[model samples]
Target chain A: MSAEGDEAIQRLIALMARLPGLGPRSARRAVLQLVKKKGALLLPLAEAMREVAETARECVNCGNIATRDLCEICADPKRRTGQICVVEDVADLWAMERAQVFRGRYHVLGGTLSALDAVGPEELRIPRLVERVREEEASEIILALAATIDGQTTAHYIADQLPGTSVTSLAQGVPVGGELDYLDDGTITAALKARRAL
Target chain B: MSAEGDEAIQRLIALMARLPGLGPRSARRAVLQLVKKKGALLLPLAEAMREVAETARECVNCGNIATRDLCEICADPKRRTGQICVVEDVADLWAMERAQVFRGRYHVLGGTLSALDAVGPEELRIPRLVERVREEEASEIILALAATIDGQTTAHYIADQLPGTSVTSLAQGVPVGGELDYLDDGTITAALKARRAL
Candidate 1:
C-alpha cells in the first residue's frame, strides 16, 4: 500500500506466484524474463495467450481441453485404438501424449475423486466417460491416475462401472515425488509399454 | 498430418518449447495448467499481459523495464540515495528490492557487457550509468552483478570509468552456481549488509 509499489508489476507477480512451482520472487523473475525476451518470446507468448483465452474449450467427450468441441485426440480417426487412457487431469493426458507412444485417446477426469473436499463423479467427467465408452465401444480403459488414495478410489469406481471392459495402468515409470510434468518421454514410453491389467 | 494435433495448442506448444528452460512436452502441460487455472490466474494474467503489451516500456536510464517511460525505481525522487546498485538485469534489481534492504536506486545494465557476443558498452546501459554517476553525483557505486565471467568483465569496465568515484562489489553471500532470481530475500539482505568495497 506504499506509494513506492508498482501495481502492474505487482499484479503480474501475484498471478505468476500462483503457478505450480513458482513463488513470489521467482514469479517476479519470470515476468522480468518474459519482458526481456519480449521480441522473440514474450510478445508471441502474449499473443498465444490471447488466442488461447478466446478459443480454449473442454473436449465434450473426453474432458480434455480443446479449441473445438472435441479434442484433437478424440477427433482423430487414427487415434481410436478402442482404448481410452483415463487421467486425473489434462496435464496427465498431455503427459501421456508427450511420450509419443500412446496411439489411443484420452479421457481427462478433470480432477481426482476426493471425499475430503466432497468431489464426486457428477462433479467430474465420469458420467461423460461411461457415455463415451458406450458410444465408442471401448475395449480397454487405462487407469493412468496417480498412485494416491483418491486416484485409486476413482480408478476402482470407473472399472466397476465398465463391467466387461478391461482396465490397465501405466507401470514402473513414475519416480517417487515426481510429477508427470517432470518425467522424461522415455520413461512415460516404457511405462505405457509395460502397462498391466488393473 | 496426424489428426491428434490441435493447431492452436500445437502452436502454443511449439512456441513454449523454444523458451529457455521449457520444452515441447513441458509446454503442453504448462498450457494445460494455464487452461485449468484460467478463471483464477490465467485470465487476470492475460489482462496484465495485454496491459504490458500496450504500456510496458524500457527505462531509458537503467534499461530496466517499466509500464511507463521510467520504471518505478527510476521515477521515485526520494530513492536517489547517492549509491546506484548496478545489476546485470531487472531480475537482479527486483531481487534486490524484494530483500527490502537496498534504499538506494538501481541501474540495470540489461546484461553483462560481452565481447564474445559482440556486445559493447553502448549495448548495455553503461553510457547512461556513466552519465548517471555524473548527473546523480553518486558517492559509492555498488556492483551487484553476477559472479559470472561476463558479469565481472562488465563490473571492471564500470569501475574504470569513474576514476575518483568510490566503487565496491557485493560480498559473496551470493552462492556459487546461483542466480539472483533463485536466492531468498534473506540471502540478498545478508549480501547487501556484508558488501565490501572494491
Candidate 2:
C-alpha cells in the first residue's frame, strides 16, 4: 500500500474499532470486505451513513431520536394512551417498540443516575419528564429501567417526584425461556416469591 | 421515532448488516451507538467512509487495494526482490503483510479454481500473473494458497505452467502454539511427516 492509501485504510480501521462491538482485528476484516465490494457494499453504506448523519436528531418533547421536533409515538394522536414508558436510553425505547405491547409515548432519560459518575436527575431529562407528565396528563409512568443499583435509584427518585401519578415497573421473575440451572440465587428467590397460578 | 427517522435508522442498520462480520442484532446495536454518538463517531465515520469510497481502488498491477494505479508494494523500488507471492485473495495478501515476513511483491488471484463453482484460470488473474512473471523476470513464485483441495489443484496447475521458474508453497504443519491433542488428524499427520531435527 502507498502511504496515502495506507493512511486512509488505517484511519477507517481505527474509526471502526471505536464502535460498540468491533475491535481492531474485526475492524480490519470489515474494512477489507468494504474495500473488496466497493461498488456493492461500501458505496451504499457510505451513502446511508451520510444520510443518517444529516437527518437523525433527538425529539424535543422526549429524548427519543427523530428527524423532527416530535417522535412518531409522541406525534401520533392514536398512541395517546395516557401512559409513558420511561427508559434509560433510546435502545430501550426501541426494544419496547419492537415488542408492540406499549401503545403509549416514551421518555428517554439518556442515562441512569449514577453516584460514581455523578450523573443526577438534572443531567438526564428528568425535569422535562416531570413537565411532560403535567402537560400530557399521563395517568401512569412505567419505569422500564434496568435492575442495576443506579437504575433502581433513578426509578425511586422519579417515583418520589411524581406524587399523584401511578408508578409501575417491569416484572422481575424467571425470564421467558430462562433455564432454572442458569438462574442465580437472587433470581431463583425472586421467581419463587413471584410465582403465580399456572 | 418518526417515519423519516425510522427510515434512516432502518436503512443504516440494513447497510451495516451487509458487512462481513455484522448481523441484524449487532447491526442494530452498532447503528444505535452511531446515532447516540453522532458528533463524535457517526459524523467522522461517515466522512471517513466517503473518503475511502472516493479514493480506494484496486492496484492495476497486483490486484491489491490502492488509491492509485499501482499499490505501494509494487510501486516501491526497494521491494523488487525478483520474487512474487501468489495468494487466493487480497485478504490472504493482507495476512501475509501483517506477518511482515515476505519482502517480495504479491499477485492476488481473486479466487482459486473450483470445478463445482465453474471457476477456471481465465476467471482468475492467472493470465496476468504469467505475463507479470515473464515481464518482471521473476526468479521465484511462492504459491501461498490455502491447504484446501482447490488450493492444491491451483498450485499444481500454476506449477505446470511455470517450468523454468522456482515455485514454493507455505509449510503445512501444526500452528506455532497448536497442541497435539487439539490438532485435527490431517494436521497432526502433516506435522509428523514434515518434522525436522532440533
Candidate 3:
C-alpha cells in the first residue's frame, strides 16, 4: 500500500476491530477480502451501512430500532395483546422475537440497574416503561432479563412500580439438550425444585 | 427493527457475513455494535470503505495493493537490491514486510499454479515475472511460497524458466516456538537433513 489509500484501509481495519467479535488480525483479513471483492462486498456494505446510519432510530414506544417513530410491533394494531416483555437490550428483544413465541410488544430497559456504575431507572428508560405499562393497560409483564443479581433487582423494582399487573419470569432449569453433569449447581437445584410430575 | 430500516441492516449483516472469519451469528453481533455506535464506528467505516473503493488498486508491477500505479515497495528506490522476493499473494508480501528483515523488492504472483483449478502460468503473472527478472537483471530470486506441493511445483517451474538467476526457497524447519513432538514426519525429516553443525 502507498501513502494515498493506506490510511483509509488502516482506519477501516481499526474500526472493524472495535466490533464485538473481531480482533486486529481478523479485522485485517476481513479488510483484505473486502478490498479484493470490491464490487461484490465492499461497495454494497458501504451503501448498506450508510443507509442504516441515515434511517435507524429507537422506536418511541418500545425502544426497538426502527426507521420510523414506532417499531413494527408498536405500529401493528394486532400486537396489542395486553402483554409486555421487558428485556435488557434490543438484541434480547430480537432473540425473543426469533423464538416465535412472544406475540406481544416489548419494553427495552437498555441496561440493568447497576449501583457501581451509578446506572438507575432514569438512565435505562425504566420510567418510560412504567408509564407505558399503565397507559397501555398491559395484562401481564414478563421479565426476560438475565439471572444476575442486578437483573433481578430491576425486575423486582419494575414489579413494585406496577402493583396490579401480573409479573412472571422465564423458567430457570436444565436446558433442553443440557446434561446433568455439565449443569451448574444453581441450575441443578432449580431444576430439582421445579421437577414436574412426569 | 421495522420494515423501512430492517432491510438495510440485514443487507449489512449479509455482506459482513461474507467477510473472512465472520459467520452469520458474528455478523449479526458486529452489525448490532455498529448500529449502537453509529457515529464512532458505522459512519467512519462506511466512509473508509468508500475511500478505499475509489483509490485502492493492484500495483501494476508487483500485484500488491496501492493507490498509485506502483506499490510503495516497488516505487521505493532503496528497495532496488537486485533481489526480488516472490510471494503467492499480497498478504504474504505484507507478512514479509512486517518482519522488517527483507530489504528487497517483491513480486506477488496473485496465486500459485494449480492444474486442478486450471490456473495456468498466464493466469498467475508467471510470464510477467520471467520478463521482470530478465529486464531488471535481478541477481537473486527468493521464493517465499508455501510448502505445499503446488507451491513447490511453481517454484521449480519458475527456477527452470530463469536458469541463469540464483533461486532459493525458505528453509523448512520447526517453527520458532513449535514443539518437536508436535512436528509432522516430513518436517522432522527435512529438519534432520538440513541440520547444521553447532
Once superposed on the true structure, which residue ranges of model 2 sit more than 4 Å away at CA? Answer: A1-5, A173-198, B1-5, B172-198
- TM-score of predicted chain B, candidate 2: 0.84
TM-score for every candidate vs. truth? 0.82, 0.86, 0.86
Q: Each candidate: fraction of true contacts kept?
A: 0.34, 0.62, 0.69
Per-residue C-alpha lDDT of model 2 across residues A76-123, encoded as one tens digit per residue? 899866788788887667666654556778899999899899998899
Q: If you assessed candidate 2 against the hidden native complex, which CAPRI class would it receive?
A: acceptable
Candidate 2, backbone clash total: 0
- Which stretches of candidate 3 lie above 4 Å from their native place? A1-5, A173-198, B1-5, B174-198
Complex DockQ, candidate 3: 0.49
lDDT of each residue in A4-111, candidate 3, tens digit only: 236777788888889877887678778888989999999999999899999999999888888789977888888766888888887667666654556788888888
Better of 2 and 3 by DockQ: 3
lDDT for each residue of candidate 1 in B3-122, tens digit (9 for 90 to 100): 224676677768766655555655666677788777876678778766665677788777667767787777887785689999887777777877888878888887888888999998
Docking class of 3: medium
Give the deviation of candidate 1 from the true structure as CA RMSD.
3.7
